[model samples]
Target: MYIKRSIFSDSFIRLLAVFLGGAIGSLARAAIVIPLAINPLISVFLCNITGSVLYIFAARICGKNLKLVKDFAATGFCGGLTTFSTVCKDGAVSIQDGEFLLSFAIFALNLLFCVASIHIIDSLADKFGKASK
Candidate 1:
């Protein structure tokens, strides 16, 4: 006997995975970031840079077959943990507060750090993966 599951069942399960992971990630972010809100830029920077590193590591570790883990950790958690909206809002706030240098610095730092973290983590993962096999 063959049993068939509906398409929506898989999607629903994936969505649930993402939702749970996102919730946890958001909470983790709030715990770290809110305390550091004395300097909003620092909070955003940490979230973004850490999230990029985490996503890269998670993707490398999980590989292609673990769709649930990849979606949960990389897509959902990292997406929730690292926020584009908050970064934009922080930049806007800085501009409104007339901290032009800080604003530009924030933008530049986020861009540079996130890019560098991804590249570095990816390279390390590749090296480690080959050595492991």
Candidate 2:
């Protein structure tokens, strides 16, 4: 029987994707964070947004059949690699630190750039897909 991915009803394979994805992403987040005492929230902003875009890009580029790559890299690696929780925390901190303007700008930047990046990738994939056929 085939099992579709859902928050609850996902089978072992899908669950594996979620679990491994979260783990790897989390580790990568730490790796990006540990090197500097600089504002990590900005770093998180960049990471999550970029990761989100790539997630969409991967989905588009791989089409539907690239399950293994999506599961391991996009879902696991990217999920863990991005840190929404940290983003929120940093946003709050930035606001409290009298950088509300900067914080708001960062939020907008992430949302805008992430959406654009995904579509850009999708467009590239579409072009390549047609050319190959």
Candidate 3:
């Protein structure tokens, strides 16, 4: 006897959620980064900051109830939107170009801002949760 399983399995659905979210996130990143007539590093910084904020909001709102939303928004979307590799590459290139200070600033500012945004969003979510309760 042969048993057939449906194509739309649980894993497949999750994969699809991530894929769709990633595509949307990537497009959103491009939309923000492409039009800016500024330094590439600055554009990338904006993307990372925005992604961090969105990731926090998604995590807070989705929590444990919305597994797919968390996976899609936080994991897939934010992962696609933020570019750690780009930051590293840019910093490396700056160092190679004898712009040591610029390289240092790039790494420092991104780390500071992203972490701060996460913390701020988490705090706000906590307050909002308490108030709504």
Off by over 4 Å in 2: 1-10
Q: All candidates' lDDT scores?
A: 0.87, 0.76, 0.92
**What are the runs in model 1 whose C-alpha is more than 4 Å off?**
1-4, 131-133
Question: All candidates' TM-scores?
Answer: 0.87, 0.75, 0.89
Q: Give the TM-score of candidate 1.
A: 0.87
> Candidate 3 has which clashing residue pairs, if any?
none
Candidate 3 wrongly placed segments (more than 4 Å): 1-8
Q: What is the lDDT of candidate 2?
A: 0.76
Pick out the ten consecutive residues of candidate 2 with the lowest summed lDDT.
1-10
RMSD to true structure for each model, in Å? 2.2, 4.2, 2.4
lDDT for position 51 in model 2: 87
lDDT of 3 by residue, 1-133 (tens): 1223454576788999999889998999898888989888999999999999999989888989999999899999998999899999999999999999999999999999999999988988888889999
Report the lDDT tens digits of candidate 1 across residue range 1-133. Answer: 1234666788899999999889988998898877764676687788898899999988888899899999999998998899888888888998999999988988889999899989988888788879999
Clashing pairs in 2: 21-76, 25-80, 25-81, 26-80
